[model samples]
Target chain A: MSEERKPGEPANEISRRAFLAALTTSAVTATAAALSPLKDVVDLPTLEEFLRLHYKELTPEDKKAILERIAAQVEKDYGVRPNVTDPPPIPGVEFGYALNIGRCIGCRKCVYACAKENNQSRNPQIQYIRVLQMRKGSIDVESAKTDYEGEVPKDGFYYMPVQCHQCRKAPCVKACPVQATWQEPDGIVVIDYNWCIGCRYCMAACPYGARRFNFEKPEIPKDELNPEMGYLSNRPRPKGVVEKCHFCLHRTRKGKYPACVEVCPTGSRKFGNLLDPDSEIANIIKTKRVYVLKEEVGTLPRFYYYFNL
Target chain B: MTLDRDEGSKRIPLAAAGAAVACLLALAVVFTKDLIGKGPGRDDIPKLSPEYADPSTVRKVRTEMTFDGAPCQACHEGAEPLQGNPHEKGIFHEHIELKHGRNQHCFNCHHRMQPADFSNFDGSPIKLDNIQLLCAKCHGTIYRDWGLGIHGRRSGFWDTAKGPLKTQVCIACHNPHWPIFKPLKAAPPPHINPRTRAKGGKTAGAENHGGLD
Candidate 1:
């Protein structure tokens, strides 16, 4: 049986060719493996992570398992065990935000508060909120200086802080080819880090530039990681994923206002249930000359801006 | 002799292959080690508990007219009526520069008889805490707006069922003396994005927000 040959070619020659072929393949593989950039030996995902299901497709058991795996990983890596869970959207609720441009003093208290609340990466400065300093009597966001570090509320400038509007018709959701992002029933746009391919198409599609891509692994200090994380919100994200404000669903779902809304000293920020007629935001929309950013684009953003007459 | 030479030549590729495999295995080991010790550190970070706004703690909008802790009566009771130009710096009150529009006379809001408290047009004394009532006499719409959480800033649970809604007093943002919001120091703007960095001024493209557009 060992000596038998099926082809016209000599069996000895064929066997020699096969040996050479196997050696070459192994050699190539070895060389490629050696040449690969193995930065931080622990960069490879564990088996469970590699096979994790998409957020939308996850079954209850899958979610539980995946969540546990993530928690264990977080504990192992950060030394602090986190409860990474997703609370379902509340019944009879739709979140809305409003900014009173008249009263916003341009102090970035809300900005720092958000960064701390969400455990944003600090070294490279990934801020979810960009408070644009626009010239008075102007609405042009393009010319609005977001990086102005000078004294705020400049004589001719008004501050307008922008974040994810959590649009009812979110362009980010539409831009995600893999369906990794979507608008929740409560009008919050969320991303599943594990599912995101980091194509950055959503970043490009967003007119407001709300989405942020993790260019490198987020370097949150050990004690700074917010242990209370939501599955689709502030759970510690890995490198190569897109993240943005989820209206602080982790806190909001638990009957808390977003950190930004809470920390606003001037009370310029407002958040409430859009479905509730008596909510503050509802009243503003009903009576005040409220406007949405880029309304012509028809994004139907839940965020509103109103001037005090 | 020829066979010996062929065997010696074959050792080179074999040796090279051996070295390559060894290097790959070494890399795999190093990656594993890095994961165990160097990845997400065990260093402790101060954990921040999720914060919820409590409406009960919110302060009512009020003005800080006097920095002097003494009751208004302590200084104004026996003091002679402010005689010189009321607008000029007074001997007793060095810092009271009245900048509020039109109603600059001290007697306008302050009760002339009971100088300790604010007053309405009817000359009835209004408690310092109830100053909003006096302001409402002039700005009815603003009062209504404040009551509805539309005119001023507030913090706390939006859903009353969940928690109370806190709000700022009128004086929280505007100085009663000045009654005007002065320019404030703005926070640092966002870092320049690659696109914005490449282009000179525009954040995105040909988009304008000014009413001029």
Candidate 2:
């Protein structure tokens, strides 16, 4: 072997072997760069390209191809086939929700359930709704609003919940750079997981402050996964994409009440179709004093509340 | 000599301008705080009747509002129409949809929740100090129940001197969407003796009471 230099000494000259080693490293790096997805190999797809397609803009062939890749990757990473499906919509069902503010206990079990069902990314947790506590006689939403200091429901405080309005004229749709989120024939808005670029423009544009961005891949236990599939709702969401409420299109389209509405103990929520005069929701709105969260914005929300005071 | 006059004139004007600017800045801070710290959908004011909370009992107010075509899906996990509404104009939220639609994040709404006294509904003052009205905005159903003595833990004191105790809002004991209220029968209309003889069908407790009103 060649003699080694002192620990602190610098090498004045290199042998042919040393020179060859340096050449080897440089050649390896160049080759790797040439083979990278970003290189002129148009056939290979970069993660960014895969994430940029909007669900609406995707052709049937594109969606199939993406799904196939996702399936193969799922097997490679987890050794099991991901249950992917586009469930049929429930027939003859018009959806509405009535939150019983008086009966909500704020245990947050529903929040956890949603994250699991939606296949949300694992990094930072995301909850589609927030329950805030406010003081009486005070219109101050901030005083009892969450992320505030002090205990909940202070001596004279009450809770308020805020969520996506699902506006009839959604601003987020206007703000999307890619057509990842678009309205369906059924009036439901959906996002193509493969098409989202994580640009986040829609989130800022939404006046209701709705929308969430995934930062990491979702981690879920197979046991907890809702075996009953929903292609849109509980069908695991992907990372580096955006997602929001799809009205449980999978189940509601299948003719059922939302999980929260069914589970509410006080019959606080009243959900139904607005079209039928005979529907419970329509009757409640027609007979009682009802209101929408905001009308000036002209979002034309599907949700309505009745006050029987 | 002319230069000295010019300096003096400019100094006076500059000082006056600075004072005016300071006052204006102070006023802006005070005025803007009200709109800068409120919950979403809630605005600078909280007047429910400003337009629709209550009108003549006979005149019907529209309630089945539709936002089906809006940008709500960005954050909402569920919004797919479950079925054809009887009217076919609106869609229903199914159990799974409702489960996924739980609101637990701030950005979901209140994109801008400022502090102010200009609140809507119940004419609640739009100040951070008065947020109960905020909860009452969408949760009016529970608010009404709270007002009728149906919510909150009751105190054991039996003093009659106090008039009606303030009933807490729906937020006091339960959540709006994901509630845990167990169903129970209403306390059998205060065990009335059927024959107390209202003489003419007054109130139900009319006959059994020897106690003074």
Candidate 3:
């Protein structure tokens, strides 16, 4: 091969070294062009954020510093200082939610209440709860309409609000390549927004379509910003991260009812610590004809739908 | 071995420089703490005060004169008290359209003598404060569910140890005269994404009908 090359190639023929150099130059140019859009980013993470350890690795002191940094960033952006907390899951308290399909008025109050409490975006609105107006005597979710207008609890229709089930064996957690999302000890699945890589594998893997991806910077109005935020739950998520209902962990950890449960006019939504045998949720499961969404998947979802009529 | 030792010795200064840089960043975080100005703590955030609907007050608002100043005895004094469906065309309670199924008697719920109090199944007078006893006569199952905090609206803390759970009375949500729930105006549905609009305007979950038995 060396002897053949020594017989000098024609001037038009390309040498291996020139071809290799050209390929390298083109690759470098393409990479630079791809990264050029990053120059316009105004909210780039500081050195501390870039070097910060994962959520599980952070000490109490490290967490406090990080919270302070986040709070400062929020105050700068929205002009309202937020109380950001990393509330730990309560021991021996697996949360469960039950909804009375018979009692639901299809009012969608819980949906709006969740959005307001969770700081979900207003424009291109992100609601965690989707109240399906299902036809009476039919459990078909595909035929259920979400955009039904006028006064609700319409004749021959029942409403079923769907949100994160916080399954015991969550598919979203398994699909996460980076392990950014995981189920807490309390059976509430949460996501570390900072660690999410925007691949949206979890979104596609979710059977309930419970996961929502932030395609743009979340646009919450200044006055409407929920000052109380949970780090793994409702804190203002950055662009390009997946978010879903976390059972309002910030409030639930503190023993308050979830915003949806509180705002439900028909008393359709029920929530309680499942471990407590005497709790309302436990009693409902034991007494009522409870049905889990997609129960065939064997996800063992904490959210249940039942009829009391 | 000598070359490897030389390389190791060269890398030590680089490692030291990296450590120094990390220490400087830690120092910067510590120094900038005051500049961040101590954002609100969990306690600093305002607590959301839950509103509990008072059943008696709601009933008073609904009846307008039943509990405010006019008592039933004011008109029935020394006269024969009208019984069995007081919702006559010219009667005082003509506005109360009694649509409650199978419950068509006035004395069945309301005390015949006292008029202000409710009647238990045994005809014992149940005060307005104990209205659940009156409701429990016919709605035994619902009363049982309500006692377990499943049938009615409960606000405030889920954990009774942490805070009080205010369970709404049946009368707060349902009118005793006409116990059926009226339909309510629903809040708006979610805004549809433009991208979804571009794809023939199908909302999420509208297409997924698989595996549902």
Highest-DockQ candidate: 1
* Clash pairs detected, candidate 3: none
**Which residue segments of model 3 deviate by more than 4 Å?**
A1-37, B1-69, B78-91, B195-213
Better of 1 and 3 by TM-score: 3
State model 1's lDDT. 0.73
Comparing 2 with 3 on TM-score, the higher-scoring candidate is 3
Candidate 1 structure quality by residue, lDDT tens digits, A135-184: 89879876776555555567777888888999888889999999999988
Candidate 2, DockQ to 2 decimals? 0.01
Q: Write the per-residue lDDT of candidate 2 for residues B80-139, one digit (tens) a residue.
A: 322343236434333222221455533222222221122454332343333445556666
* Residue range A77-105, candidate 2, lDDT tens digits: 55567755565433443455444454443
Q: Which candidate achieves the best TM-score against the true structure?
A: 3
Which is the winner by TM-score between candidate 1 and candidate 2?
1
- Global lDDT scores for all candidate models: 0.73, 0.46, 0.77
Question: In angstroms, how far off is A59's CA in candidate 2?
Answer: 7.4
Locate the minimum summed-lDDT window of 10 residues in model 1 chain B.
B204-213
Question: Ranking under DockQ, best-scoring first?
Answer: 1, 3, 2
Tell me how far the alpha carbon of residue B178 in candidate 3 is from the true structure, in angstroms, after superposition: 1.6
